[model samples]
Target: MDALDGRLIRLLAEEPRIGVLECSRRLQVARGTVQARLDRLQAKGVISGFGPEVDPAAIGYPVTAFATLEISQGQGADVRAHLARVPEVLELHTITGIGDMLVRIVARSNADLQRVIDRVVGFDGIVRSSTAIVLENPVPYRILPLVDQAAAE
Candidate 1:
């Protein structure tokens, strides 16, 4: 990874659908060179996968929230597996903070959100839980810093 790779990542982060020919033209490099670099990046897992970003509201789930979960002794895996089965749960993460797991959920409305939370809190070994509803999502997602690319030759 190098300046070239950084440039490529920045461009792709903005537009993952950009073609190799367009990338080469923008970077002033040969098409094959752009293709090779992308292949190498993917092979090394620096570049994962790409896809469209959809709105949860447009998909019928208008409500979004972050849930902090506290589990009973030795119930982390059980709680995690239970959360995974729910379609409303968009993302789940284990953290070192006060909570055992953090979950992102989307629902249709307040009633829907309550239902989802009720089901989640009902899971075995779940001791306590809290939620913060998202009033607005200003910056949802962004590309990670390309440290390897920063140190490239």
Candidate 2:
């Protein structure tokens, strides 16, 4: 992506509600140019979806936890399907190391977390599971810095 594209992304990241006309005015480009850039970015999969970022904590799920699952051999797909049915299972990753899969989950409380974990490991393929509760988030998830670095390059 070029400097203009970077600027457009940064602008949108800062103010998602802004229109193409407003973006053109702020970036000093034509409305069509802004529109075209946004369209191209979406087509290229650089900008995926414009969905609102929801906070689980704000939605009554204050507790965040990560669970590592050791599944039976050749049961990754089955385990994944099972986890997909659970609403609290926010993110899942096929990880390397001791664990076969790592899942991020949220719950209303510590008691509720146990129930979530129970559901997560209920599948027959899951042989063992370990959980680590997140106590704090000093650095929240972000991509702006990476985006800036890419723009600089």
- Per-residue lDDT of 1-153 in model 1, one digit per residue for the tens? 788888888888888789999999999999999999999999999888877778889989999999999889898888888998999999999877798889999899998999999988887788899999999988767654645346464
How much lDDT does each candidate structure score? 0.87, 0.95
Off by over 4 Å in 1: 144-153
RMSD of each: 2.5, 0.8
lDDT score for candidate 2 against the true structure: 0.95
TM-score of 1: 0.86
- lDDT tens per residue, model 2, 1-153: 888999999999889889899999999999999999999999999999778899999999999999999999999999999999999999999999999999999999999999999999999999999999999999999878888889889
Tell me which residue pairs clash in candidate 2: none
True-structure lDDT of candidate 1: 0.87
